[model samples]
Target chain A: MSRLFVAMGLVLLVGASLSIGVADLWAADIDAGLVMAVSRVPRTVAAVLAGAGLALAGVVVQLSVQNRLVEPSLTGTPEAAMLGLLGITLFAPGSALLVKMGVAAAAALVGTTGFFVLATRVPQRDPILLPLVGLIYGGILGAATLWLAWATDLVQYLGTWTSGEFSGVLRGRYEVLWLIAGLAGLLWLVADRITLLSLGESHARSLGLDYRATRLLGLVIVSLVVAAVVVTVGTLPFVGLVVPNIVSRLRGDNLRTNLPFIAGLGGALILAADVLGRVVRYPYEIPAGTVFSVFGAAAFLWLLNAPRRPAHG
Target chain B: MTFETCNLSITRDGVPVLEGIDLSLPPGGITAIIGPNGAGKSTLLHAMAGLLSPHAGAVRLNGRDLSGIQPGERARSLALLTQDQGVTARLTVADLIAFGRWPHHQGRPGHEDRAAVADAIETFDLGPLAARTLDALSGGQRQRAFVAMAYAQTTPWILLDEPLSALDPRYAHDIMRRLHDLSRTGPDARSVVIVVHDLGVTARFADRVIGLKDGKLFGAGETGDLMTSDWLTRLYDTPMEVAEVGGRKIPFAA
Candidate 1:
């Protein structure tokens, strides 16, 4: 599709998303303008930022690993974030949100680095082995997080980050998510190098890219992006996995050309999930995480079964 | 433009691959590195191109240590196409060739870069297949495109490791002829070093031959002086003979 058409579709989704809510701006008792300014705008932007960030993270992971099956969180980013969150909640008990996010980011870096090392060890055949390893690795971190939460009586707080929902997103609470914009901009600068990485280690290095440094940088970027999303709106499972795959399948894996599409479609998919969640039971809302995974899981299955087109050697 | 290695000893995890490998290569001709398996021919090629750092001694370009050269400058000095040509991603032949211009342009390709890419496409006769992804092409076609990529780099030294190992006779000869022309033509001619199993091509096209045995330099000299039956048999540790066909000496094991 044309860029303009995609832009128009995005604008339409933004408009519809802004308008579809239980509390009407047209209601006499409610100040429509105030409601729109504070709640709707933050929630919508959160969805877009989270979506864009996760999908961008997805492409980075896939390209670096050279495996389509892997995504950001599979490498234990969210579970690591939970571990960070639980640790902070236990020790400080009243740490600032940004400080907590900082801790989460650190743990995420370690977790991601571990996954990267594991990925290098796993031979690149079947491709499914890497993700399965990541899933089990993430599960180990998850078990640790729950054990820590159970011990410290912080299970309820863990619940909040486990289920991704935008209902709690409001003014002044979600400004940290704006960092996604900066991260995305940072990604744009290194997009070309990242694409070269998919050419494999020796090939990219022979072309003068500092291959190890570039791979480490990509994983760090994935860690930071995943940390931000997990901290802001809990975990959205397949936005990172499904969106990039769709964009790559539809277009190609050239990061420069496909990044915007990946980011845009990611935003659109998340917003659609949020809208679907809100409207499905009317006043009673479902978590966007729950909604997307149900559909995202099916999409993942479809992606897995989709006959790989490229006759790769 | 002399390429030389000084007492270069390369070790992987304390196990030596190449030891006391002191040698200098004359510029502006095709040089072939011929050896048995595990003779470290590929390692020497990569080290000469500054892709591998020697555990001892140095690879020098005109007396300057290659290890001290910045990666971008090193890349501009020499282009190395490794033994494995398997690229996981499918990029078009034109785009893949354009990547050789990466060190020059980084991300921004200029007029010169465009001209070089076009020149490579024409020189390799990849015009018909330029728009097609490497995955869609036959093995020989893909190999040609890859060689064209290395050619487009405009480097003085072009190092290839077993580039024609998997090709049929026609494709093999086709590539050898093109590379022979590239290494000998004009003021901008490049020095080509290839790890080759095909002694026929080596004997016909190579100006100098470097023989490797058990990770050390066995012999290095002009093709005519070093490609004799005695040296060939000693280098391979097997009985061998050089047969003359149309005045070309082709070596064969007895």
Candidate 2:
């Protein structure tokens, strides 16, 4: 029943996303069909893909570390990707976009792996500590990225990448995000193994799961999603954390059952936020990252204070 | 088919936890591995279940070396319930039990998997609480659910590490009774090996006992013959006595 509401809400959000843009499709002088094909559709698809990818990445990180508070933003994934981009741009000025994304994905994997290692030492008794560490860790990486960008006089590029916005998305540029669709399919195929991962290593192995291999697979998927999103739409914080958490609360942690809802809700909410970003400024844009930050911050506080559910780990 | 550990020795951080230990377990009965704190009882149990790689020697199940066996095959042969397997997710009793059939079905659960889970739920009397998440259940109930999950694996061997810890006498006794019944000599009987801290419970339930002290095998024999006051006294390095009341041996510190 609730799923029907979600579906309807998603359809409405998609319609809104398609209809609203700066070009004013109804204007007689404008090439409405060309504008819709080139900008509106691609922008809408970018929002959906980036939001869904982040949400799935968040699930992977949270489950891998056995903590609920973690997301790609907190884990330094976006920062690491930005750092990698900066390095590649400095070394190879004319590198292709795909090559840049590949380097960024590798760096994100390393950064996330570092956090996973740090998570082991952090006590699991307190659910809040892991995310706090991740925040500091990401802050450090963000500082490093900023320092590199400043030294290289690439702060302008950094600004665009750090603040997620879909204004620049067009038919040709935003297509890299299509990779998230394939990754989501992969997540569905291994949904049960991922769920087993929520069970601690001992029990998971006892149930015949190759715990290390499965966790590595999850990490790789998370890195790829974060890189793809970072490359296409910049870093959108809290979409992954907030969406998966809401779905988990509503539907439980059965990833096989919750994947579609998580992905759909994430995509819809982010697209809705993007549409609001367009309408609120009226011919200007607030940047979906900025608009969603306002709402994501409030939701995050509510999630923290909301009477405690079962603490992961 | 027999389960045996041949010259099994485990070293963690260059310190031996179980050294040059060996014993073939008798089939079709409850065997309790008991020792004082840090006696490496749990370590031995984990090694036997193929969870740990021995620094020397091997654990063999049905004439196959456990180290050489694939994890899926190993899971089908034995189900291990380790202490403090954290409930990180809000998994319901039914969801957790269904995971036991993972080795057989991998991800796609068939009718046999469903039937096994149903059988396990019925066996553990968890039908009422099947829908409730693990955190919602009491300690005793949660422990029962975990045991049921291991049971649902339908393995020939079940290894448990200190399952009765923190439970009151009644819950502990109830769990032991269920295991004892399932472990009785029969075609379907499972071989049960548990790392136990309670001597009283061990005395009342365990058919055979393996005693470990300071990472060495202190003794291993039939419970009736080896659970004497003198044997336990030496094993624990404390004065101990066994009182037989109503045909049941009860061990206590003197």
Best by DockQ: 2
Cα TM-score per model = 0.95, 0.97
- Per-model DockQ against the true two-chain complex: 0.46, 0.56
- Compared with the true structure, all predictions reach lDDT values of 0.88, 0.90
Q: Write the per-residue lDDT of candidate 1 for residues A127-180, one digit (tens) a residue.
A: 889999999999999999999889878889889988888998998888888988
Q: Write the per-residue lDDT of candidate 2 for residues A169-273, one digit (tens) a residue.
A: 999998889999999999999988998898888888988899999999999999999998888889999998899889877777888888999889888888989
Candidate 2 lDDT tens digits, B1-254: 58998889999999999998988986788999998899999899889888889999999998889999999999999999989877667778899999899999998899999999999999999999999887677889989999999999999999998999878999999999999999985898999999899999998899999999999989998989999999999998999999989988899999
lDDT digits (tens) for residues B93-138 of candidate 1 = 8888988999898989899999999999999999999988766788
lDDT minimum window of 10 residues, candidate 2 chain A: A304-313
Off by over 4 Å in 1: A309-313
Across all candidates, what is each one's fraction of true contacts kept? 0.34, 0.59
